[model samples]
Target chain A: MTQTKIDGRAKTREIKRKANLNLLERLYLPEIFKGLSITFRQIFKPKFTFEYPDVKWQPPASFRGRPVLVVDDETGVERCVACGLCARVCPALAIEVVADETELDKERYPKKFEINMLRCIYCGLCEEVCPEEAIVMSKEYELVFTSREEAIFGKDKLLTPASKLKDRLEFLRKMR
Target chain B: MESILIAILKAIIFILLFLTFSAVLTYVERRISAFIQDRLGPNRVGPFGLFQPIADVVKIIFKEEIIPANADRTLHTLAPIISLFVAYSVFAVLPIGEKLVIDGKEIKLVLADVNVGFLYILALSSLGVYGVTLSGWSSNNKYSLLGALRASAQMISYELSLGLSLVGVVLVSGSIQIDEIIRSQANVWNIFYQPVGFIIFLVSVFAETNRLPFDLPEAEPELVAGYHTEYSGMKFGAFYLAEYTNIITASLLVTAFFLGGWYFPFVDIYSGLNPNLSAILQVIVFFGKASLIIFLFMLVRWTLPRFRYDQLMRLGWQVLLPLALLNVLVTGLVKILL
Candidate 1:
């Protein structure tokens, strides 16, 4: 064994070929006592358990949850321009969009937009491909459906308020 | 006739107490193990999960009982019954405290107080092996058979040391009767006289109870629940109850023999108190000591990993047996010399 000084601290670099057991170690009882003491002390330490259902986990900004259409808070209209890039980029083919002329400055808007949550892989590819930053991943991960019809999320279900998705939008802006 | 009636009443009360204690022990074991691992155990069912065992019993009772095809039906049913029976019956001879006098009639804390109490305990505990063995054989499953084989072999190997270790206690106390042994320890506890024997006894008891570090019979990784693999519903619950009961019995025996049963050390505070009150205090003190040993049992279970079968065998026959015998020899020599 050799000792080397790194950052003013001695670090042993050598590895022993075999462990040399002393008389006390070979006897086994002393080692057993050491292990017992460790567990005994741990009984007083704080628990790491999260009582699920009663207490829920809040994921961080980087978390990629369900995809949603961002609804503008000021105008009360969806930010989607109906470019069909999200529909094309979806690997699961979960998204669908129908374009129509609108009175808004964007000119084109989705007449009918839907995302089949059942088929969604949650890959965030749609969120990445969208040029308008209209579709982004929201923090709402709890998706439950009773039937196939219910699983196909329509405009009402997919459109989330922009203010509610600020954390994910900010994270995406910084990362992108 | 009156003595027989008193014995029956005592037996009923003890049985109820043991059953309740074992149920509470399951909860305590889970809570303690969780604390050791930095997790909260089952605290959802009730406050601190005290009612978890009751929920478990209800679930087990409602579950569908499944006996494998081509398995011997009689022995399959009989195995768990035997296990539970032996676990409960061993306590019959265990002296908990000194005599209680009520209405000018004396009552012994122990149910039987048999003269051969020591031999009786040894005999009944060995009989507990039959339950494990029969369950494995009757299951007709390879894993169950392997578990039963391991259990019987381990129990038989450790029983030698377990019996021999107590011989030192018998020698120091000069009697095989358990109450006699307790009476002898009134001056000084047997652990001070036979520390080697105590260690050997403690180790052997761990093996005998099929606890962790020696639990080859139910080694989950290898044997897949061992002898109870094919058992389900209340039948499996029977085996579970029996295991916890064995732990309590082991703790009680350790307290009675080595830690000085029901006697407060170096003092006789009971001399000035009422006889009935003193007897109740003695019973409380005995159980308090036993619960400490029980805590040690739970601690050891969570501390050490299971020993390999070969290592377990070597530790039993090669190490503990020789040590127990030497302990007896030295204890006898000292008795004659002094």
Candidate 2:
């Protein structure tokens, strides 16, 4: 503790010494003027920025984006088997599942699945944990709105129909 | 009736001038700092975002003015008005542009050619602390009161050095009138002769204005919103306006004292020009110097971190006060000897 206090005072004196040096430098003024000149030049230089909304930026291929549930095209239904794997894998405890025995060929499916997007850490472990090729993480990142209800992606919001997979895949392909 | 009309016109001109300059200074302070820090600031509104100030004005005008129920109603309303008035009134003594000749009748550049212009400026500027202090105290909040106390003490402490630093100029020029001081520096600017006094004066101005590096009163992390914690809408805007006006006033004073007012660099070449043209040139030159000084203020703000309240007080009492006094003493001796 004594050593830290001594070190702090020493640092302060060093700072004062530097300040004196700066004062000496300002006595010449030309050196400071030169620095100002460089800043003035860069002030007018064209800024490097891309237009957003109209032109979306493409992130790297390994970039994880929004999470979505996969659908079976041949069966014309969701591929999820009500296994509760997604809920278990989510580190944030963001995902919740409510499975029920449905009349879709008597296979069990989620009756009421809810994922709180605010709590979601976007870990993509949900996709990895799904037994049947049911969940997939897509590259659709710009998700924002006013209401809390809108932010929470339910089973209806998470389950991207089979028809939309082709468009999502095309966007992903173009990003590369 | 004619004198009253002229006086009314003069008041109108000065008030409009102060408000307009303060508005534009808000834009300039932001833009200049951004430039120094290598970033573009406010370039999306009007051409180069010149209308950003106008947009700010509109926003402030339409904003909901909130008054806390527990707060003192009269002082809360009066605080910003007092700040705005004191700040705005100081500009009457400040000469902005070149003298104009209308119908061969010569009119001076300054709004009011007060004989004791320097004293007027110092006295009015000191009054600005009251507005800040009252707002803070009347808020019935501890943070606001603390901020106000810091502000009042800081302004009062710095006012001494600020006044003393300029004492050297008053001693050398032998005139409290700003125009006369400008006239004294017609040959060589006072800055060249009394650089130490100028430096001391600049530092004190920074402290007195409660700007960055001396902005301990409103240190956002420490004091939250400071004295204006409960202020909103035009009340908040008034506080902001007062600050910008103070900056402009400091810049003008610096220009009038250190830099020759409206005196162009190559006046020898322009000496052959018509008297009217010469005056116009001088006005532009004056404003150019003031603008550069304002730019420097913005630059230093971005470059330096704020001083702690204790450090600022110590610097004022221990360092700047003595230095300013010494400058006056030395200048006096030199004036007597020479």
TM-score of chain B of each: 0.98, 0.95
**What's the true lDDT of residue B107 in model 1?**
95
Docking quality tier of model 1: medium
The most accurate candidate by DockQ is: 1
Deviation in Å, model 1, residue B234 alpha carbon: 0.6
lDDT per residue (tens digit) for residues A83-164 in model 2:
9998998999988888989877738998878888888887878876777757667767888878888878887788876665
TM-score of each: 0.95, 0.81
lDDT of 1 by residue, B35-133 (tens): 998999989888878899899889999999999998999999999999999999999999888888988999989988799999999999999999999
DockQ scores of the candidates: 0.78, 0.26
Residue B241 displacement (Å), model 2: 0.2
lDDT of 2 by residue, B85-204 (tens): 998888888876546676776777777889999999999999999999999988888888998999999998999999999999998888999888988887888888889889889989
Q: Superposing every Cα of model 1 onto the true structure, what RMSD results? A: 4.2
* Candidate 1 lDDT by residue in tens digits, A138-174: 8777888899999999999988999999998899899
The per-prediction i-RMS, to one decimal, reads 0.7, 3.0
